[model samples]
Target: MVVLMRRRLVWALAFVLVLSLTGQEDTAKKPARTISIVAERFFFSPSKIKVKEGETVEFVLTSDDTDHGFHVPAAGIDVAIPPSGKGEARVRFTAIKKGNFRFECSRACGAGHNLMRGEIIVR
Candidate 1:
């Protein structure tokens, strides 16, 4: 009877440890906010983005049909998104004044290379 009680106690302690570990894992896996940007033939979807001041945003950039690059000139951020492959970048900035920031694909695309531009409005 003593041996059986000890076995039960061991199992209960193990179960509690497992539950504590799981709770910690859940807290560590909290999701981060994301902003999706699609790069297609020659344009950036939405053409403009609006983001809150001082918010950390994960930019999930994807290219649809061809290889492309996402470059923010003002921020000096450049990341290439391969065709059909997902890429990610991040930006967090505080806005003291309202203005438009220009962004474009630095990579030389086809005829519309110069036209591939977008803006970010911060307020």
Candidate 2:
């Protein structure tokens, strides 16, 4: 009976530890908010983004067809989305500079690769 009680106690302790760690992770890495961006043949839908200083934005990106990329050199963010798929990448920065930053696809897709660009304004 003593061995059985000890086993139960150990399991209870493990469960509590797992719960606490999960809660901490949830709070620590939570994004300030989420923004959705769509990539098509040659453009990003909602081609312009605006955010405040110190705001952490999670970008949910999807491709209309084939594959495309989202890259912001100034912010050092580059992510690729599978065609018409759901996934997210995050950017967390204190907007030390306030202006227009141009982001483009670092990956070559087709004839419009060079023209695939967008802007982010940080205020």
Model 1, 1-123: lDDT tens per residue? 999678556645644554454345344333346678887778998788886664434566677766677777665556665556433333333333467888787678688878988988876
Which stretches of model 2 miss by more than 4 angstroms? Answer: 1-29, 86-94
Error of 1 at 123 (Å): 0.7
Residue 85 lDDT, candidate 2, scale 0-100: 42
| Residue pairs of candidate 2 with colliding backbone atoms | none
Candidate 2 TM-score to native: 0.68
Give Cα distance to truth, residue 104, candidate 1, Å: 0.5
Task: Residues 48-101, candidate 2: write the lDDT tens digits.
Answer: 989786565666667787667778888665655555543333334335577888
C-alpha lDDT of candidate 2 relative to the true structure? 0.68
* Backbone clash numbers for all candidates listed: 0, 0
Query: What clash pairs does model 1 have?
Result: none
